[model samples]
Target: MRQTNEEKINRLEELKETYDRFKEKPFQLNLKRGVPGKDQLALSEPMLNILTPEDLYQETEADFRNYGVLTGIPEAKQFFSEVLEITADEVIVGGNSSLQLMYTVLASKMFLGQSDKNSAWAKEKVVKFLCPSPGYDRHFNATEKLGFELIPIEMTSTGPDMDQVEILVANDASIKGIWCIPTYSNPTGVTYSNEVVDRLAKMKTLAQDFVIMWDNAYVVHHLKEKKEHVQNVLETSKSYGTEKRVWMFCSTSKITFPGAGVAALGACKENIDWVTEVLSDQTIGFDKVNQKRHVKFLKDKKHLLQHMEKHAELLKPKFDSISNLFGNYFGEESTMLEWTEPNGGYFVHLTTMDGCADRIVELLADIGVSLTEANASYPYGVNPRNNSIRLAPTSISVEEIEAAVKAICLCVEMVSLEKELDSNK
Candidate 1:
């Protein structure tokens, strides 16, 4: 399989011709988003019909219309508590979109500070966060918008490099928090192990009120027959008297309608009370009717699993298609590219040859194929290595995934070859 100088040149020419032929087609293929496809969205149609004339009131006897339940309805608290495996008293259901909730949490800290320590982030000389790289960009952006310095830690197999994390937090009080997508992490899809969780819960930070933004956005979003387990960070926090240290966030955005789904936060009593107080000033209540629809459809943990299983069935094939392309189209084993074929979550983490991601994305875009912009997974939208790409396989059809992967592989090879040629010269 070794190619000589002449052969590599010929292969490059052949790829250019093939790419040109694809460009001649009149269709545009977009794989840029991680949104649920129409078919996936349709799965929630049953929820729309789950509510009827017989039930306008919750079991707690709270009316769905009038503003009464400040945090959430009793049943919603019960339902989310079961799903998150936390006590009902610890869960606070909020409006749709966990991203919005996450931003709200940060905003509250920046504006009002936590109840116990009222050092507003804006007043701090230098507020910083330990960001695990190859992470969710939105999380980084939230901190960035408020002007908190983001210092990235290397992502290891088990989790963020603990040695680096422990050292940094121990030395600097300015490092107030870390952003983690613990279960089935956003782009890379590696769940944090129990040992990592234990260390985080016990880690020493100079800041008395250090926070851990544990965005468990994909806790139940499984994509394999054998589901993965992410150790409960919040629960572990209790043992260290750090129960108020972590803020856990999740939503039914993927489970039901992303546009109208409900979100929840799992925390200790202190954190829960603080957020409730701040949120009360903002609004009387979140949408109870929407919460009712979700509770009616997903009655308990078992029903939630059953519903997620359907999403897995619809998504697995698309994931397999990307795997096949990695082995078949790119190579059975490629040196030019590397990726994480996650067992769960919505993305496949792709890393190209050094200094090649931006070029590959640009090359693909010229041919009417769209992907997430390069460096999107990192803080500041700048992948220092310029080699990482997040591939969202669950939103498109099998055919679209195939086409998109082919084009992606083509651009990958194209950029890699160009690099090799330049080095030789």
Candidate 2:
């Protein structure tokens, strides 16, 4: 028999009765992260073996061990540069973590300051950044830690609300930058449309030194048939004469080992030169040894595409399982629950009825399922809607995903039922 929304509500009430029985036990299961599962890790084992000491004990024509290539070896930079569709000179190869590179760039500006720019952020009376809502928490945290005021911008399926963004940038001289994840944005998985990207590229900011911190983390992590790729901001910026207005970032954290993979920064020559000036004071250079390994393993675009297919093979099942669960449990319902079916990337953004997220999250936690904090996606840990929740299906097994989704649906149902009851009262 097909269950109507009311019937589902009743069924959920019954499930809650069953859940109440187990409330006394301590609950623990983590579906809160977007890290790759163990199966995905196995795919990168070949790279490990390829980089062993025995494989290159003696330095070949290109030295792997020592250090000295501040801009990275030509071949390594060339290989990764292709991934961004930019030239080698426009890319700076960094050590394992892209997050580290992002932090370094921001910190350098906050402490050491940029060349041809003002002194450190400390000298400014107030510095502000445009934070797209329901964004990467770590990005927000980085700016907040440095005392920059974070102003939240609402996001649409196409992209951040550009009208408001332009207003903010055009009027606020203190608004120094905006953080963007153009492709497969963290929890939402919504790719920025070309129109949105173009508008951003052409914005006339009040601050001359304003920047768009573009974190293209999932540029190649597609789950379904390929969608249209957004134009490179580096290229788009140049077309609008805003070449120095963007700093693009990417990494192989998902492709290879997260902590041990190489990362890169793509920007205009002026921006790169400014970054290099401060970077000289920071460290000698990033890891060149891993750079050689990445270049050797992922030799060309063909190799990269083939390797990513392996990741897709492992990831698709997990996403499918969770999506199936959502459909099975809520397809017929007209309740205030909604979610995005993302084509790629690591998360599904879910929104419940207003003021119900915290309750639903608490219910799940009480029943042996853990989720990312309900408001962790929003700026300053406050979701204005109080309803958005991020679902990360990458780390757990398919079976665990099934179990977690079942528990999550029950919690959602309970919250919806309670809301319905309150309205009736």
TM-score of each: 0.97, 0.93
**How do the residues 242-275 of candidate 1 rate in per-residue lDDT, one tens digit apiece?**
8878898899988898999999988998889988
Mark the 10 consecutive residues where model 1 has the least summed lDDT. 53-62
For each candidate, C-alpha RMSD in Å? Answer: 1.5, 2.6
TM-score of 2: 0.93
Report the lDDT tens digits of candidate 2 across residue range 1-425: 55566775677679778678657663556878888888888888887757766433454554556556676777777986888888889988888877877888888787776763466766789999999987999999999998899999998888899999999999988898999998989889889999899989999999887889999999889888774466778898898899887888999898888878889888888878877766776667777777878878888878888888888888888888877888888885646588878888999888899999988888888777888999788878897779988888888888888878877887887788777767756
- The local lDDT score (0 to 100) that residue 284 gets in candidate 2 is 73
- Model number with the top TM-score: 1
Off by over 4 Å in 2: 1-13, 21-28, 52-62, 116-119
